[model samples]
Target chain A: MTLPPLLEQSVAFLLPYDFSPTVLLVCAGAALLYHRGWRRTRGGWGQALLFWLGLLGMYVVLQTQFDYYAQHSFFMHRLQHLVLHHVAPFLIAVSAPAAILGAGLPDRIHRHVVAPLRRNRLLGHLYAAIQEPLVAGAIFVGLIYFWLIPSVHFYAMLSVPLYNTMNWGMAIEGLLFWWMIFNLRAPGASDMRHYGYRLLVLFLVMFPQIALGAYIALSNHDLFGIYAACGRILPITPLIDQAIGGLLTWVPAAMMSVVGGLVLVYRWKRQSQQVEQPLSPTLGCAR
Target chain B: MPRFKRYLILCLLPLLLGCSEEPPGGWYGHDITGVMPDLEFNLVDHRGKAVTAEDYRGKIKLMFFGYTSCQHVCPVALSKLAAATRELGDQADQVEILFVAVDPKRDKKVLDEYVTNFTPDLVGLTGTQEQLKAVAKRYRVAFSYEKPRDNGFYIVNHSGAVFAFGPQGKTRLLIDDQSKTANITADLRRLIEQSSI
Candidate 1:
């Protein structure tokens, strides 16, 4: 009685789509506006869009794997995890100034939501809390090794609830991981070089996965029965899927390194402009 | 103007003189109070011994907050603490190291074993969720659990400073995560000697 047929249909339609990307954009825009308008709108949005485009590309990669092979092929399953968990989220975090949210949002929403957050003491504390390096770093490394070990990953793969939980867990980990690395908030502050170094550290974090993936690809051991089943169904050989899995680990991770570097450059230039701004004539005359 | 300048220089004299320190080292350059906040708590140790902040009195306690399930930083910090203790040799006796598990639910007994695997001297501590919150609040330590989507496995967020407590059982210093073992050893030695005096 609570659910009519049309009501059920409407609820089903509303369930799948996520508004997270738009929410993030609005938040970024608000932060940018609070800092004042970008020196150039198109340029700032373009850079942000470029980063968003890269994120979209990675998301597509994830969607393809999730749709086609998550349950069907072990190799595709792992690749999907890698893309969603590590690759796409990092691209999104480093892609903006806080201004994206401000620029994109309507005035009424800005007054109601954005204005309040800018003044919020709890939000400030929350920001400070997450920026704690030890907390953020541990979460990142913990999720990786915890999920990577054969015992855990194998069990998660076998169980439906665990598989879904872990898949999203990695993405959340990815968000927290890059938030510490990309966010300008304090409690833990690292310069551009440190950010660059941390990316290398993250790359090393995934090294074990690459090695394991490569080992699985090269060896005849079919840990999962599905990989064997899919090998028979596919046009290409199983070797190709295995190779793709290993290569995907290192190759896509390079995107994170490049993203880190670009964020460093962007932040540094923004800082320099603020620091080296020419003094007003009125102020100079007073001096 | 000369009198004003004299007073100005007089006020600034402490800033200059305060920069000076004793022979090998001094912890005066940084504002220790800003880096470390006063914290007090009652908890239990790995051995199930009832413990409180008072137990660490008279010794300079080096405290690191983390969970046993942590794969990298926790072990790295404990190893560094061990290495620092080794580096101190005799002086290590004066410094007490404590690791408080942020995820007390799973980490209570689990961390106890994990930490012992690294160093017997390192004490692993935990309490009920409410108690952990009280301790974390007092210490200005931040932590959160990201809800697990499918399985019950989620990450615990926590602060990662190696806090140094004075002999009087008050937080007196904080060593940033990047602080090296050699620097930690030197700092601990100085804190131990200073507190004794």
Candidate 2:
């Protein structure tokens, strides 16, 4: 199918790009609140920049050629997964969108939307459970392995219900997992212990991806059969395409995890050193 | 002088050998240099000799999925391949053309004479119905024979693309039919040179 020119397709850049009511409401509401929050919170341009960039990343992944060709190409699909499950989530978390957006919402919307959700004991417990390093890590690790299983992967491409659920599952789980990793506070524990736990979780997550990538890269057969008839644009064989996809998921994804962990360590060290002076207390609270 | 010669020799070795390395980026057909698909087969050739993928390991194999019975695509594709081989001239010995018959039932008896009609060197292979299906599945070659007519001759619709593998036993490329005969010949010649390296 011939696509409309990018100049003509410029209209899709608007949020709620897909007609799903939930995505529309959430994106629209977040934009309004984030705008207000940026102004009200005063002088947090860095945080605002990261948040907007995160949203832009999501829009590109969902609306651009990445989403269109991802169905037919393994490497492109890996790219979509990387943006949604890793990069966008990291940026979104670092921006602390929840706190800023909550503070910025109008009184009635806050009362009806944020207040009730905060008040729900069941949700509070569930959210608290997912925030734990072990639970969050296990759930995230499970999702990575579960989706890539050949039988599961093949059918997910064919079934709409399964496919949508998998996409949403990755987005939500990724956001939560990265958020919990960076925000490692637990009740009254020392920040050192918390940082240690975060570092460990980051290390643990890399193993599964490395193993999955090695298997795919090293395999001689066409593990993903869905692309058996498709891969001729670059005129690649199915096995070659899959190997490239495996490398994308394997090495770069692992490097990103390590980089995130290193940044946390550097920040933690800076905070610990600052604690010797008066400014240390506020530095720890900022992230 | 000895040190300079050693340095020059080390640098030139890779450029000369080119083995255990990738070909240059731009090529005529698909450039799948390292992917090894399931090309295993233990079938009798038209000449009644047992042949497998290993037997053709040292040469570039152009594998086609077609049969002789009800024929337009099969004949055309195979004939073009023969032309491509002739186009290779002196280097033609380095290529093996494999025609795997889709209809094993009727093709078992006629493959030799049929394949020779195009070129004597063109190897025709057929297996039992179960074995043929297994091979077809390996190459992702989907074909179904029509329910046999009263005359007992039915058309077998199959994937007609030709898959080329390098001498290193790695699946390399799918030659496009739209590619000119000379282009196809150049592709095969390149493949032969690439594997010999």
Candidate 3:
């Protein structure tokens, strides 16, 4: 659907520059105080509420940025999607008060709440979810594939809301899928010492995008329609921006893989050393 | 003349090869992934107060080891971290995120300003070369400095993972390069719960 030009221009103006309005900050503070008392009253409810609030705040900032950047060029629009869906959710997750929530509960109440999560039905479901490494792998790989596809990417660029949905949806869903898989505490078969394996999976996951990037860098063709049309006003060329995106994707992914491999190797060596060494007699005797 | 040549050759051998000894491999705890040695180091914060692994005890710590000059990943990681804390709201009070510069020479005020751009709660740190080496050694985090030839721009090689520590100042988990917020939060949640006395 074609956006009204006036509406598009206004949203475009607001998207890049939108900050957390003063009123929202005050409300967020008030919400914090309101939630503090609830912390003792409910088990995980407070945490869930806080999580939603945080998500809402982020959504506001991201939406504005998305709107602003989407109007200007395809590259900034993609970046907005990157921040909104992938990075934002992850940040929100990191900010979660799991430790506080877990600690504050009384043992009885905690057990009452947590017992259901560990029951056969829940455990069975969780176990199945965590066991499917391919599912997580697919989500990670698929998101990159779908978004990076030239036709699909350009389509999203043309329709701002579609771009928001596709980009953010892929990112959020991908993170959730990976979260379940990587989480050691999740149900399913427990031992996952193959740190190298996990690293390789993500490496393979990123390989296609890198391949796409190399193709873009080498090709003489002007692929992106949006950039091709709006050439004069935009400061940078689409090809250069595309190359930068490709570089961003590959370099960080490669580094993560290498460091992850080193950490894995280091750990495997340590675990083997521990096995070879005699246990402390006192600790063994205590057991 | 023959004796002088031999002496010069002998002197140059240690300078080149000796500096390349691999960093120590042993660390104390199991991080988010595998069992590895806890890296140890001493560096001063933006406030000029010195901090060690000990000082960070009693709180869940998120540590990112990077220099201020890093153009991409470091800033992205720090920005995401700030976003996470902003997302955390009250929960942020319990967490401390630190950015330690691998490049000690240019790190101090520069990193401090850079970090504050992301979040007030974030602390920027640097140290003397000896101190940086010691800290990087303990963490098993690696870094190398490259001198600029023509261009003013030079680069330092450094690790990209953000290490998470439990309340006791023990290394609990590694954030890795992925920087997935959910995975980090999930692990931190588990660590926080497990680490409490």
TM-score for all predictions? 0.40, 0.57, 0.39
For residues B1-197, could you state the per-residue lDDT of candidate 3 as single tens digits? 99999999999997777566322221222233323345356788887888887777677877877788889978888877666555555666777887878786777767767766767888887889888766654554446666764867667656666767767666666554554665455555556567655
Tens-place lDDT digits, model 1, residues B69-177: 7778778878888888778888777778888887877887676678678787788888888777677545444456766758777666565567778778766765656
For residue A251, model 1's alpha carbon misses the true position, in angstroms, by 4.0
**Residue-level lDDT tens digits of model 2 in A176-278:** 9988877656667777778878888889989988888888888898787655432222345667888898997899878778988987888688767876685
Candidates 2 and 3 compared: the better one by DockQ is: 2
> What TM-score results for chain B in every one of the models?
0.80, 0.81, 0.75
Best by DockQ: 2
What's the i-RMS for candidate 2 in angstroms? 9.9
Local distance difference test, candidate 1: 0.61
Cα lDDT of model 3 by residue, A28-63, tens digit: 654464355346635356445645654565555454
Best by TM-score: 2
**Residue-by-residue lDDT tens digits, candidate 2, B20-44:** 3344554666554443363588787
B101: Cα error in model 1, Å = 54
Clash pairs, candidate 2, are none
* Candidate 3, position A53, lDDT: 55
Query: Which is the better candidate, 1 or 3, if ranked by TM-score?
Result: 1
